[model samples]
Target chain A: MSNLMTNYYEAAAVILFGIGFMNLLLAKNLIKKFIGLNIMDTAVYLFLAAKGYITARAAPIIAQGTAARVEDYINPVPSGLVLTGIVVSVSVTAFSLALVQRLYKHYGSLDLDEIMKKAKKEEKV
Target chain B: MTAVNYIQNIPFFSIFLAIFGGIVTPVLGNGKTAQKVNLVIVTVIGILSAVLLVHLWQREESFTFMMGRFPAPWGNELRAGPLEALLALCFCLVMALTLTGGSRFLQKDVLPGKQNLYFTMIYLLLGSMLTLIYTNDIFTAYVFLEINTIAFCAIIMAKGSGESIVATLHYLVICLLGSGLFLIGISLLYSITGHLLMENIQQAILDLVQTGEYAFVFAVVIGMIIIGISVKSAVFPFHFMLVSAHSVATPASSGILSGLVLKSFIFLNIKMFYCVFTIDLIRSLKITNVLFVFGLMGMVVGSISALKERRIKHMLAYSSAAQIGYIYMGLGLGNHEGMVAACFHILAHAITKAMLCICAGGLIEASEGNVGINSLRGAGHRNLVAGIGFTVGGLSMIGIPLTAGFISKLYFATATIYSPQKMVITLLTLAISMILNAMYFIPSAIAIWSPVDKKAKIPKPSRAMQYAIGIFIVLNVVLGIYYAPIIDMIEIGIQLLES
Candidate 1:
């Protein structure tokens, strides 16, 4: 239990992911589902960044005259990956929001259930 | 660089051409120019991919092209084996054919001003698909996967109808969730190995397998990636969104979406499994068993439901789901023969389904855009060429001995021979699915041919559309009769792919 407590960052990230995934599935409102999607994306990014960080480690950059070793700096790859992920998540959010706007226009509601009903009605014709 | 040297870089060059096309096509911004530009672009790309295929085959070894000066695990890279080249070649040709064949539908469906945007989206979608095929970097693959999803959604939206918007929203949410899961899987794998290059990642995974450490996390990652891909590829349970998306999309978009786009996700998974996880690890993990059950279920479920669909396009969409089940069945069998069948089915189904969707669209056009199967009565008589095209495509789907579908089915049957435990179930499921496939397909094919009150003056598909369909029909026959070279190529390609 104590060992798990020491890794709370990861636990938190995983929890956020679980919550986001649940929200995405359970949320009736399109906007909330979209929020859930972003939350999930954000959670993954957090996990990735957390994986790259180490206690007492300096930034990846090396100063001109400093004697440096590999362990002195945290691994930089995951940070770079996390940045890319963030950009991807941002675009996804933008795209979904645009979609939500379209949905709002077409169905006259943000409620997925109502929207689905409209879609079903439309399909019959 | 010398001209020959330039030709040697065809893989990279073709990718560049597609990206250039995506950027340039939109700027041209009109129907005439977009069509002209698109023609030039697709033709050039088709020629390039074919040339690349020949070049790679002749070389007879995998070519690893480094994207920068940085070494493995750092710099980006692209690898070309016979398999990748052949897929790119097929993708280019099918994409071009679908676009050309569906141009009339595209023009009619999309707003006049936004047609250029539609063309732009198409080029970008092709560009992204090609990127996914060639990229050896896992991170690059993910990036391109996002780009591919966005561009595909954009193509659907260019229709600018309420139904398409709803359909695109449904499609996007599903795809984003799938991709998100995939990204998390990638991130987990990266954290474990500290590597993003496919080669390095494979090496790290091999180490884990050898040591038998981190087994639980490994299994979880595997599951995540598989589920993610299953959603993207519309494997069995995750396929509810697919019929809606396809039914609402334009003919060309639907053809490309159902036929080729979905298969690329399967390709990515194949690459991941073959390139990273050894077959031993896969079997030990029992991933194959899971796939086997779901695939069998899909085969039964998809086809049975396809029988109930009233709309022509929707019925075809459901059949595609069942066909995808065949590919998964091949994957689940978990052997070289099974993998080959899956790969071959990808090619066969792409050709058959694209042809079917295009022909269905033409039939609907002949019916004055009535989508219901009732509207299809005597549609064949009115538009003889489309009727013939649809028949040819349908016959191929039925797995007739001389057609491509038979080759896939034959391969699947033979593949079942190796997996003794799965043999009975595989054969049983396959036989039942064929009957189910025939149940839905034969009735619809007959229904379309049966005469009804003739609605006259239904315009036939234009000259170009006819030629494209004719070419596709011929291609299906050629693939069926002369399958030796392709199978051999796949074998050689699979070997090189298994790094």
Candidate 2:
């Protein structure tokens, strides 16, 4: 079972993605949802980076002779792509955190359900 | 180099001007200067895209310009056809007009010190939309997708109420989820096809279909991309967040977000379905009917919800969901005419919805920000410009003859002739939704024009806003009356897209 689990990195990345997606779907608190978003972002990056990995292949280096041999090195495009994904994820996380700070300041709660109940109560006027 | 080569640089210039506007806006230290910058940026882009449209129409050719000096496999690309040019033109005109018409509201609603930030976000949003349309690289589109999402969230939160904050958070989370799913889909595609450029990916997909071993994963990727964009566009089941987000947002932001931002994704979706995977392949997979059912559900549900809602902005927002369904219906029809109708609906809906949202702002101002349906009583009488704009927009939405909305529905009606069985369903959906459209819009139109509370409370709009609304009214009428050339352009554009 352990061998099967570790045999495929793509399966691990996909499972992580499923967990993150489920968290995003079911979480009630705004902060928890933010965490869910971060988790999902990381899972995607993991999946993207895994696409570059090749068994028994060296890192993508162009040291003279082996640079001519395509099979000697892993694909570098996915690694390059992972960098871009990480940057986008960082910006989103920062902005969402700023928004959560303001939400907390206004409602005195981070839970969407509680805040909604209070907001509705306040709107009764 | 020939002059055509320089003329081909319009898309690049349009994108860079917007990026430059975004950077310089905050440093200008005031909203007034920032507004001028926004206007100037959009105007120049609009003119340039219009010029490019004429050139492309005359030449009947598409062009792709490589970024940097990198060789074919490594270089990024900007590709444009008549359709891309026309969309860029519409987006710029609508953004400029909405900004002009809603400037006063922007000054009033936004915190005084943060107005420059608002303009900054607006510019960034425009830049991202243009990039999304012109990008030939898949990764470039995803990066711009995230940028547009963040910029839109900022504009919504620029209103700064508790409700606005909550709305922004909700929209942000949803966007994150959608984009995450989209990223997974792109990775799967790249892994399978080993290509990121759209044309290469298309060829790879064609070859993959021939081999037929990875069919399940291919279908999953297709579903993921469609669902991802559907979430972004607020198609049917994902529409619950749209009403709150659009309504809580300031009127100008609401206008731009609902009008242009959502359409950008739909345009991308059409490109994906048409360019990335030919409609024939999509049809073979039998996903066309699924889109039709979802579109039908959206039309029915969105209109009925609007019929029950009383707030004018919420009603308008719900109507947007329904209008998006109309575009989807066109897409799901699975013919060239259906694609044309969908694209036409994109333009018509953008102009009408922006005009309506901006005019709604005027009505709210006249009523001292009372958003209730009845409070709009005599709002038209009070603010004559708001009254006229609202009536014209409403009529167009309800599909009156000689309006752009009616033409789109007419094209859609003809487009439905492709499938004899679905013809009845298509027409029935249009007729019922139009009635539902009238049920909500007519009442509000009457409420605005009714004579009970005719006293003018809100001051006359600023000169700029008045000019903006005036231009919008003329533009809508022109789009309706002079639609033949536009239709021809879409035909040529679709031809370019097809090949």
Candidate 3:
């Protein structure tokens, strides 16, 4: 059952990645693309978290008054890495959103095509 | 090991001070006082870092420091090997110079109350870069990388121009993709290796490769790592974002971006390749050949783009891309001499590029933003010191004899001759591209030095501007001539890699 769950998680990750890449390529809306990116990031976090799992194991944290048993504990490294990854993704998301707001103000349109056209026209002038 | 231990407990107090000082600058003072206080603190940190680096150089020790007395292979570790120390030294010196070099421009148009925020970002950028280089854990490195990226975005936004905003957004989009790819790659590595420690993972990979048990997985893992780093370094196929982003940033920000930020990525790449992947695996994977091809292409294409560009900053940005190619090409050679040449070029390019950008900033300010090559015609006589800075920096970029750039290029070219692949022919062809560099750069140099046009009426910058230009010019010339000490230090760093 645990192996089946792990397999499902892996498939979900791959599907999310595919969807993200598609949106990145197909979508014209800047914010939509950012949303796709966030989705993809979430998929990666899930995948990493799943990889650290151990069948019939408890959480990495040691219970009070109980001696630590390494054999029954899930690997903590990937979880730690995922935590850092989540923080990094959040930071990127915040900064990119700020940049998007600025872009909206500058080009007066969030459409990438319109902004490029306007920029090119200004350059020519 | 004995030498390592003696130096291990010295403590990286100076680095901590610099980082803490940067984090607190915004909270401690008002706008006017913040800039002065930050500058003083950064300068002190720079001096202390240099002194520590000198001591380390003299002692010839390299070791990792575990934070809060945590043991390595588990807890967070700050590795201060010779290479890390050398890079830290370079960062401190460049930060000091850029702060001093850009003060005049900062003072001229006191942007009505963003001074404290600006210095705060600068400090954070420096601190992040130091941490990025010093950390051993890949995840910790990512944390610092995020800090660096956010700080850079903030710096770009601080300029508050419509163009800067657009460029910053573009940069953010591209960087997010790159960082996303990077995180995915790290996750895959973690899943496979089950060890967060780089050295242990390297050993595991080496053992597996030797046993031939997981060849396919090994290839995929290595490919992911290379692709991730390539994006960060803004190598070919991923360089579209850098040109506009660097060009639109403020001159001081451009200096930091080009001189230090990109160098941080390159630093991480070197660590990822040399420290995390053994030499045999790298060679067997034919990654070096791929690097050579890309490097050569960047050298040619970047120079061509620079030649065609009309805007001064855009041209400089493209030139930076070309210079990055040179550094990578040296790395691809994968020899001691190649490593030395690459390290030397990093220092030379940082100083020269920063000086050039600062001078361009002064010119733009003096002319009230009318600074195309055509508009710059005959402005040289108006501001001779700025003109001299441009000429000196331009000469170095072109790799003229007696300049630091010359030695780096020459050494790299010689290394190509020694390469088994007979890269000498390619080096010769790339050297010819320097002619294209001269064609684009010389006109600007001449415009800076030629008699002022009666029609243009460009004004001279203030004494502060003159002093800034003078400092960079002196740096370019003095470093160019007296580069032996630096060369010696770099050689020691190369030896550390070999060990």
lDDT of 1 by residue, A71-122 (tens): 8999898889988888887887899899899889888999988999998898
**Tens digit per residue, CA lDDT, model 3, A1-125:** 78557589776886887687566545678899788878878888888888888788988888799999899899887787778778777877777777777778778887888887887776667
Given candidate 1, what's the lDDT at residue B58? Answer: 74
Candidate 3, Cα interface RMSD: 1.9
* Candidate with the larger TM-score of 1 and 3: 1
| lDDT for each residue of candidate 2 in B1-499, tens digit (9 for 90 to 100) | 9989898788888899998999998899989888998898899999999999999998988898888888456778888999999999999999999988899889988988999999989989999999989988888889999999999999998878888888887788778778887888898899988888888889989998988868988889988887888788888888877888988888888889889999999998888887787788888886677888888889989999999999999999999999989999888888899999999999999999999999999999889889998988988887788789889999889899878898998999999888777899999999999999999999999888878733554687667767777888888888888999999999999999889
The C-alpha stretches of model 3 lying farther than 4 A from their native spots are A1-8, A21-26, A122-125, B1-11, B28-30, B107-111, B453-460
DockQ of all candidates, in order? 0.68, 0.71, 0.62
lDDT accuracy of residue B382 in candidate 2: 77
Docking tier of model 2: it is: medium
The clash number for model 2 is 0
- Scored on chain A only, each candidate's TM-score is 0.92, 0.83, 0.89
In model 1 chain B, the worst 10-residue window by lDDT is B1-10
Q: Write the per-residue lDDT of candidate 3 for residues B55-147, one digit (tens) a residue.
A: 777877666787775676677777666667777777776776776667766554335577777788888888788877777778777777778
- lDDT, candidate 2, A1-125, per-residue tens: 87557746778878888888878877887778878877887887887777788889988778765436888889999998999998998899899889989988999998889988876676556
